[model samples]
Target: MAGNDQAACADGPDFGPLAIEARGLVKRFDGVTAVDGVDLTVPRGAVYGILGPNGAGKTTTLRMLLGIIDPDRGYRRILGADRPHDVAHAIGYLPEERGLYPAMKAVDAIAFVGALRGLPLKEGRRRGRELLEQHGLGYAADRQIRQLSKGMAQQVQILGTLVHKPRLVIFDEPFSGLDALNQGKLERMMHGLAQDGTTVIFSTHVIAHAERLCDEVAIIAGGKVPFAGPVDVARDRIPAQVRLETRAQDGPWRAALPADARHEGSFWFFSLPDTGIEPLLRALIEGEAGILSLSIERAGLHDAFVAIAGEAAARALEQEKPEELRR
Candidate 1:
């Protein structure tokens, strides 16, 4: 449904224009702040991720941006509309709490969702069937919701979200119940959506998924955003790691190593020198250190998250289950 509408930019993906913008957004529940001055700027046609641990206000922040609930403070704009609901027809939302009528056929269910977004019932049904066929669910089209597996049912709902061909799509914890195969399918779907100039946003505590799919991310902890920017920028906060194995350890090359360098077995590890690797390379070669293997490893999103949001937040991300499961 995505690539049919708009062709991707010629040179590269154009994430210049802003699709959603929020400033100093704050929300409270019973006087306890749920979102604290969260700010975000999501670019058009970009796949953006909101990363945080459970109870870190990611959902609350998304709710505020969608105008599902009024923020206690701050303002937001969606698709250039002052009120998000004014342009609701152009937006698709797959909330964390998934639900559909158990009695309805999968196609009928998808069509019904499209109808709510102002799509013609007849056209919706036609598109629903086509979508089902495209997503390898054609055999299940006539089947009732209750007849499908949990994953299949969720896929139906996701197809419903896209039936209207929304310009902007938001998914909250869409991967929670999905198997690895389904998760990969969803990732491809998000990529297709972005390539078609659709602004895609999703929230997740799983750093791996975000790292793989998101062009940019906002890392939240304790209801506050510690860092929000391009994934590369976040990863750049920590220095690259250097791993070196040499034939001779006691040489001039050893002196070139950083003060913080540590030896373990036959390898020496340390952060990449601020002066850069060229000097170190020259020293090693000139000193005849007999380099066996040398590697520079950049920090991953998980490491960056720990550095930015602290170890406690990272632990919460690893330990916390989905809200529904916890409940």
Candidate 2:
């Protein structure tokens, strides 16, 4: 409801303060650059998302950020601390792969991890109870971890991440096994956390999930970032597509559009042009076909992702050695 005080998480880099600056991050594996030079900054109480296709180096980046691995070259300042993982006591991290102990009771497993993150066993269990109740999983706390469904397990992992009251939360593929409703629940929880001033960073393969949940996003492909900005601003990277929905039998704008643009039923499609489709639409109005609706369709985050991915692919192809392409 309140968007202005969006700095809810980084009130001063103390309680889950701003922890989103990574500079010139470079990671290499076996003489191959997994993450090329890249710089990113996220504020406190901000929902920052990292997105890319499989094998696009997203996991490597997250691993480095979590301190499970370190960058060969780079620097990061998180939560006012130079080392993010060392401050695990205040940072909650949920890896993409589920790591819950199958035989342990869900509640006990959660508390155990909280304890590892620095909570006393008693307080860990107590806080675990509160988190379960808060996230609507109180009834299932006593069940064995393996007995829980995939969605339930995911919720448990998320609960565990936050059990220790970490200020900065990192989630990799948080929506992995969720149906729409469950995903929505997780999204709501994420929003609630940000509202309470927790700097939340997540990595996802799906553009839509990141688009909906993040205040800002970084789209990385082929170890390069082609787009890193606000969601609405990213949409403008691709020229806005012009859509026309009408019953007119003879739409004059059809031939002017790119060959890839299609006409289906009452809808005529056209990609954003250099000068935009404005002059063309004005021409249509002058011709008098009785316009129904003529507006620029907002490009989705997926569209922007695809646009950058295509560019990366092209660049990679150009940079690929002749021997590599032959193989």
Candidate 3:
């Protein structure tokens, strides 16, 4: 039955101009909807992030896309194949649950994982050793997984995921167990992969990582996507903010300030007026408002997430718990 499905996916219509496409994807478990009408479009060679709080259906959505679980309604294509596992050879996936044989040596575990993905044992071992050495894990290559620290073991699994040199890589909550140094290393590795033209997708509640690493992102909340597009586009949904420090708090120019503007000490904060800053600046100068300092800054991914997904979802991100518990 699986073989027949693979054949059908192989012969299915090509999904043009996108690395991943999904329309109205829906999934449910035990009569409870976990994902609802989620859609995504990921371009080739881009680093895309699925950004959401815990239990917001990120894992379920990823599973549906990867064919690990089927959606109740809707369709998806990965690497132009109608079924994701049909092109399994071209993809690498790192699940949230981390596991490796404790008795196996680090390099052997990596090689073993590659072998499951159809890489020959001999060549996989060679690549595994090379990967370990390149990533500064050469000294631990011969050490058993049980001998390594949790972070080191996780690093071995990450290398194993890449040993086969896949075209599309998906990582679910890949940063959970790593220390700050390992997290920095992983960020660099992701950048290197994107530079080599690989498509990278990851799910995370960490807005900082998505802001720094993702070219595009989808913001999911309450099992629905509120926004999905280039990172810049999401941030641009809110206008730039203005911070003005003036020596004079009371002047004719005060009327030019936004009605909702607030001040702390000498600084005033408000959104950039739709009329633009030029008019405001002219008014300030003419009224001798004594502008001391001025800065206009666009909203960041965190602020954008709050605005798009709501405060409830933002709180969920801050107080992250196991997804199962939330569900």
The most accurate candidate by lDDT is 1
Tens-digit per-residue lDDT, 261-318, candidate 1: 9999999999998899999999999998999999999999999999999999988987
Q: Ranking under TM-score, best-scoring first?
A: 1, 3, 2
Candidate 3: segments with Cα more than 4 A from true spot: 1-16, 321-327
List runs of model 1 lying over 4 Å from the truth: 1-16, 321-327
The superposed Cα distance between candidate 3 and the true structure at residue 156, in angstroms, equals 0.6
What's each prediction's TM-score? 0.94, 0.80, 0.91
Q: Write the per-residue lDDT of candidate 2 for residues 251-271, one digit (tens) a residue.
A: 564455566677778777777
Cα RMSD, model 1: 3.9
Top candidate (TM-score): 1
Pairs that collide, model 2: 8-197, 9-197, 16-167
| Residue pairs with clashing backbones, model 1 | none
How far out, in Å, is residue 144 in model 2?
Answer: 2.5
Per lDDT, what order, best first? 1, 3, 2
User: Residue 181 of candidate 3: its Cα lDDT?
Assistant: 84
